[model samples]
Target: MKIRAYRSYFIQELESIFGEDEAESFFYLILEEKHQLKRIDLALQIDLTFSENEIKVWNVILEQLKQEIPVQYILGNTSFYGLDFEVNKNVLIPRPETEELVDWIIKSNTKDSFSKNIKILDIGTGSGCIAISLAKNVANAQVFAIDVAENALATAEKNAQNNKVEVAFWNRNILETYDLEEQFDIIVSNPPYVRNLEKEEIKKNVLDNEPHLALFVEDNDALIFYKKIAELAQKNLSENGQLYFEINQYLGKEMIGLLEKMNFKNIELRKDIYGNDRMIFANR
Candidate 1:
């Protein structure tokens, strides 16, 4: 079948589930992932045909999409902070907002007159996206990451290796830990901030397929992870060190209040590209 002909069918099948533009985007994403052919390649070779075997593979992917499975999981990988990471059911797919958080850390470090050998820790490091990105971007960064799930830590370890950056991975639950063995110049976490009550606000594709442990907290205690990480940072962060978090968009004021109550200095809440209060920074 001609690839162009297949494109119409693919888009029609997914348009109801993901909007027209997103469904169209998925087609090009799959095209590049499966055939190494970009949209321009398909346009130039308008008569490009798919073999029966290729069509079968695409059909299977289409069925999964119908079930609201994330395309990143279908591809088994995703790009974040200009780096590739392997993703699965065990770990959350890295999001663009988290990329902004990583960018903030890198930019802040670059502007500061800190020593080259900086220690950084990423709590609840699912897929190790933040930690790996920081290590890759910040020269002389010593990155460490911890996750409660052993499977998540395993995935994060592989991601660290795949990104060609060394990050120490630990299988410890941050909620239970009182102290980190060493002080860090920077501490960052994109922990589970999605409250249980906010599950309806999440898309079906994410709510149905993403790992819940890495995405949610009890609605009554939405700031559980944030509070614990901040408390630990108070003890383990070096003098004048920075703490960063990708927070729940709805809890901006509450987050600021928590930091203020903790006496963290120079606390700032920043919005993502979508103008949502999605990240926060505090200095200890």
Candidate 2:
């Protein structure tokens, strides 16, 4: 059948579940991925057709979409910080808010400003988005990442190689590690910060499909990863080093207080483009 007619049916089928705008976006993303057709191509050439086999594939994807699986997972890859990354059930899909976190780090430190290669460590480095982005953008950055899950680390290592960035991967649980390999010029994390009580706010696409191990923490200890990473940062960050986090927006005040108590200096809590307090930077 002609692509436009199928597109109409696709949008109609998903509009109630994802809303019209989102459903349309998903259609175009799949179009580009599967058929190499952009939205403008569809507009200019409305007579594109999918073969029987292609339509069967689209039907499988369509059903997955109806079940509210993330389109990135359906596609098996995603873009972050202008780089492509492989993603799956093992890693949290990188978010735009995280791109902002990465931009902040890249802007603050550049190779031209440093006399030597700066070392960075990313704790709970799901998908290695933060570390790899830094290694790619920040010149002279020797990046390292740590994650508890071996499979997640494997995915992240694959991302690093695909991005052509040299990042050392460590398969260690940050919460259990007292000593870092060495002092780092910067330490960053987007650790699991969502509390159990807040699960209701998560979209079904995320709650149902994304890895819970990379998403949730007990309500009573939502800051557990932060506390552990902070303690390690205190011990392992070089003089005048920086620490960054993609934090729980609701706990900005609490995060600031935690850094203050840890005696970190020049604490700055930043909001993402949506104006939620979503990231923080502190100095040693």
TM-scores for every candidate against the unseen true structure: 0.98, 0.98
lDDT of candidate 1 over 140-172, digit per residue (tens): 799999999999889989988888889998889
Please report the candidate that would top lDDT against the real structure: 2
lDDT of 2 by residue, 68-180 (tens): 88999999999998999999999999999999999999999966878888899998898999999999998888999999999999999999999988999999978889999
Off by over 4 Å in 2: none
Per-model lDDT: 0.92, 0.93
Candidate 1 lDDT at 22 equals 94
What is the total number of backbone clashes in candidate 1?
0
Cα lDDT for residue 10, candidate 2: 97
Q: RMSD of each candidate?
A: 1.1, 0.8
Each model's backbone clash number: 0, 0
Question: Which window of 10 residues has the lowest lDDT sum in candidate 1?
Answer: 107-116
Candidate 1: residue 35 Cα off by (Å): 0.4
Candidate 2 lDDT (Cα, whole model)?
0.93
Q: Give the Cα error of residue 183 in candidate 2, in Å.
A: 0.7
